[model samples]
Target: MTAEFHVFTCLSDNIGVLMRDTTTGACASIDAPEEGPILAALEETGWQLTDILVTHKHLDHVAGVAPLKERFGARVVAPAREAEFVPQADLLVNEGDRVMVGTLASDVIFTPGHTAGHIVFHFDGAKALFAGDTLFALGCGRLLEGTPADMWHSLQKLAALPDDTLVFCGHEYTLSNARFALAADPDNQALKLRAAVVEGQRADGQLTIPSRLQDEKATNPFLRADRPELARSVKLDGRDPVAVFAALREWKNSF
Candidate 1:
């Protein structure tokens, strides 16, 4: 049986995701952004909450972990590097570790940029990535606790994933990310088309999470930092891609 997913909004713009293995009826929440929405989704899908997989120590992502665990006796799986922050974690994982939600297994990849210990869960069999704040639809996470180089390297790991992979990020920042993308790569036809689509989607009160990695590779400015066009866009045509990435990140900070 295939893995199933349910995406919903929680706590303003935060995106809450629930994954389940159909064969064994095992369910896991990507991050417990809020308790009510998670409980509502569980009730809607009738999937038992068995696990809480945490990507980072951000409060918005983990605020509901304790409460939900208290309610369901769910196991909390979190990053080992930030174990102190997630005191409820039952399993602490690092890079290359595999976490199993019933029969579905996800490879743990440490993507430390948004936070020093941030990680993304990649379910290779399902071709899905649960990228907390490491990456977004048209943008990436702000370098709050890591350097631009750290973020750039972290993005590279994500960019190398299979094109067909589906990316479920942590927030609903696609429209704004699209606007910034268009400004950074004004001549990108693909980005222009995507921006228009995002605008229409938002205008119709739609959610734009779970974007395809293929589309993101083709249009996301942050992922295209190594390209010459992005280099020139930042007026650093001959600089290294890391430098280009740094410039783009700085511009995006205030965009």
Candidate 2:
């Protein structure tokens, strides 16, 4: 049976999602930005929380974890490298590890950049990815605790996923990200069109998440760093893809 996902917003910009398997009653929480929304989502869906999947050790991501776990006696699955900070973590996963959400198995993909030990959960069967802060719709997270090179490689790992994958990231930053994308890639018709669409979506008080990986691959500057056109747009022609990616990240920080 297919998995059902409820993607919601919290903490001004953070995102929280709930996943439930239809065939079985297995349910999981993907990053708890806050408790109220998560609890509300659970009650609305009538899906008992069975597990908490953490992408990193960030406060916004784990703050509501304790409350939810107490309520449901859920298992908290977190990255091993940052286990000390994750409260009541029951399972510590690393790259290539398999984590089960009921009978469905999600692969652990280490995507450290936003944090030194950040990770993403990829459920190939569900055709969905819980990317947390490693990537965004039209942009990516800042290099808070990692080098540009580290983030670039991490993004490459995520980019390799199938184009049809639906990316459930951790925020509603697409409007601003689209503006920066235009500045960096003014000549991209697909990006320009996407920016307009994003503006309208935000203006109407809508969320632009669960972005397709195909769209990101075609337009996101970080993901398009290897393209010669993108390199020229950033005035970094002939540079390594990682360097171009670094320039884009720096440019975005101040954008």
Candidate 3:
């Protein structure tokens, strides 16, 4: 059976998502950004969180995990590479490992950029992906612990997924991402148009997330580093995609 996903916000901009398999009523909480929101969502939905999927050991992502685990006995799954930083990880997974959420199985994708052990959960069967900080709506995660090439390679892996994939990222920074995207790829009409929509959404107190891969492929400057328009906008026309990507990341850091 397909997994049902309930997405909500917690903390400042962190996005909290819960996946429940209707067939067996097994539920998974993608990340515990805060105990209040996670527990509230469970109570509101009346769904017990049976598993906790930690993308990385970032404080915002794991701070409330132990409480939720204690409260609901939810099994914790985290990257084996950085289990020391993650609390109470019952299952240590790496790239290509598959974890079952009741009857549904999600493929593990190792995307090291924001952190060395960051990973994403992709349920191809359900066309849903929990990207964490690796990939966002119109931007990719900031390269903190990893190099630009490492981040680029990781993003390339995600960009290759089916275009219909619904990417649930870790934060709500799409409005700012859209603005910077325009400067990075000024000639992109699609991006300009999307930025307008994003502005309106934020003004109305709406969430502009769970972006489709196809739209990102077309308008996301980071993902379109190989495209000539992006290279030209950065005045590095005909440059290698990796080089362009590196420059773009640095530019966005200050943007």
Best by TM-score: 1
lDDT of 3 at 138: 98
Q: How close is candidate 1 to the true structure, as a TM-score?
A: 0.98
Q: Where in model 3 is the C-alpha error above 4 Å?
A: none
lDDT (0-100) at residue 58 of candidate 1? 93
How many backbone clashes can be found in candidate 1?
Answer: 0
* TM-scores, each model vs. reference: 0.98, 0.98, 0.98
Candidate that scores best on lDDT: 1
> lDDT of all predictions, in order shown?
0.95, 0.91, 0.91
Per-residue alpha-carbon lDDT of model 3 for 29-107, expressed as tens digits? Answer: 9988999998889899999889999999899999988898888889999999889987599999999999999988999
lDDT of 1 by residue, 193-255 (tens): 999999999999999989999999999999999999999999999898889999998999998
Better of 1 and 2 by lDDT: 1
